[model samples]
Target: MTLETSVGNTQSFGLSSKYVEKWEKRSSIRTRPEKKIDFELDGFFFPEDKQPVLLDGRLKDISIENKSELLIRSLFKYLNDIVTLEIKLINSACNKIIYNDLPVAYPEQIKMNAYTVIIDEYYHVYVARDLINQLKARYPYLTEDALPDSDSFCAVNEIMKRLDAEHHDLFEIIAVCIFETTLVKELVEFFKSESVHPSIKNYVNDHMNDESRHYIYFLELLQYTWDRLPDKARRDIGSNIADFVKMYLNIESEKEFNLNYLDSIIADHEENKQTVNAIYKGFEVTPDVPIVKNVISALKRTGLLDDENVKSGFTNIGWII
Candidate 1:
């Protein structure tokens, strides 16, 4: 029977139910230790070096002006590009993989299929377009040209294209999972914080609420996929996951571009030499202070940062523990 037919006849009736049933059946019959393992973020480790930098003063302390607001709106345009790129990359990669290997009967296939479903629902083109329009209207300074086109999205598409060409191993998949899932979760939290701008805050809050659901779906799907791998594959997957986490942590630490609101804050605080210096220093340092450390730690705990594997890999690479 066709996959669609198989799904339609299933007694469970919900968007998520079809995959949930598939996972349940697969998990029930699995006998291997790895296959039986439950994934958890508890006890996950993050690098001491890759923490987030804490600003010296409250976000409100930064003066807000029309110029600053305009700058903040512009920054959102860039951020929107990043988000759109991420969604497209994951969706395209997953689709390409599944399309070429149809009749997906395995647990991994089911999980991947689930991810595709979640992305389709979460990143519905119409909904995203509407939201983007709303944001642009609210922040008049945002330029239409800043929006990412199919060709000019972020680095994610290129990464996925390379992975597809290389026929990425399980480790690579783990790396992707670490990056995509972790960012979605972390960005949600960052957006929800009171420290963010009011307009930016509202936008982020809406995205965060949707993202929380998406995060749960991805995590569950990853666990379901990981649990079905053979022993050697599982080990490889774990190792790759670790390596990817390390790479992500390193890259995240070096990201220094100012978001619109952040740039405005920096400009406002520029007159205060200590605060300006602190902000500058914060960007220069890797995972520097309590606030930053907590951010990375939280991401690690949420399965964004590769804890153990990254730690070991960094140590081997001669990066300070």
Candidate 2:
């Protein structure tokens, strides 16, 4: 069950009964590693050399060991907040899919599928909180005070609100679909990075295993729901889907939450400014970023990218080449 995000891929081959059988045989989240994080290593949470950590490319020259440690701590806090937001969004999406009746092509199967996703998502939240708590207990320098405020949700709502009340739920579903789509892509580098903490790597590996299934689940779910949507609704929501991909891919933290956490890590406002400048010195959302490419790939695989409006929207936003 490998899924490549290309337009017409689903319909061309069809999600035959074989795909559902694969879903039924999906692995359990209980298989996640329960090992403790080693706090002794310097590169566990942050890099030792200060090479542009994750998507931020500005930390190239700011190579002081102390600064690297601070950057690592900041990165960990950033991870915590991002995971918290995922928990919130997954819970909401699962609730909507489980409790409410969306126009899914297969009701009983989709509900069963949604239940499994809900269970896995809840467990992911648990894992995220556990990891954060363990870090706080061990390091004491890691901040638990950062709120999980997200600019992405605000961006989501702005477009969702434009539609009549009945279709608002679709936006939520699409948002989660897009997140789960991009998230797995974004983690590939993190999971593969030898510089990252083993504990962090294991955690991401567990998530990657679970989310590989999720990616398939949501892609099929999107296809199911899309087939049943009215044409006008299709065009509207389809365009909005592109908006979400671009929004989440922006990679810039708004002043509200992510930035504030960065501020706390730098300890002083002036240092924070310097660190911010350094981290983003050569910032650009080129196709090299896995999230951008993979998200577009997801959209294409789901057949949404085939929609005229969607393809054009993505092109206009420069998410696709």
Error of 2 at 302 (Å): 2.2
TM-score of 2: 0.77
Instruction: Please give, for residues 1-321, the per-residue lDDT of candidate 2 as tens digits.
Output: 233222354452113344445545654455545646777754446444443332333444545665645555655655665565566676687778778866543455565667777777777777777777776676676665554445565666677776767777776777777777667655655446666777677767777777887777676666666666777778777777666666666655533343465564446776665655666667666666666777667666667767887778767767554
Best by TM-score: 2
Provide the lDDT at 88 for model 2: 63
Best-fitting candidate, scored by lDDT: 2
lDDT (Cα atoms) of all candidates against the true structure: 0.41, 0.63
After the best TM-score superposition of candidate 2, give how far the Cα of residue 123 lies from its true spot, in angstroms. Answer: 1.2
Q: After superposition, how far is residue 260 of candidate 1 from its true place, in Å?
A: 10
The C-alpha stretches of model 1 lying farther than 4 A from their native spots are 1-63, 67-71, 102-125, 135-141, 144-164, 169-173, 183-185, 193-203, 224-243, 249-256, 259-312, 318-321
- In model 1, the worst 10-residue window by lDDT is 30-39
Clashing pairs in 1: 50-287, 51-287, 52-292, 72-260
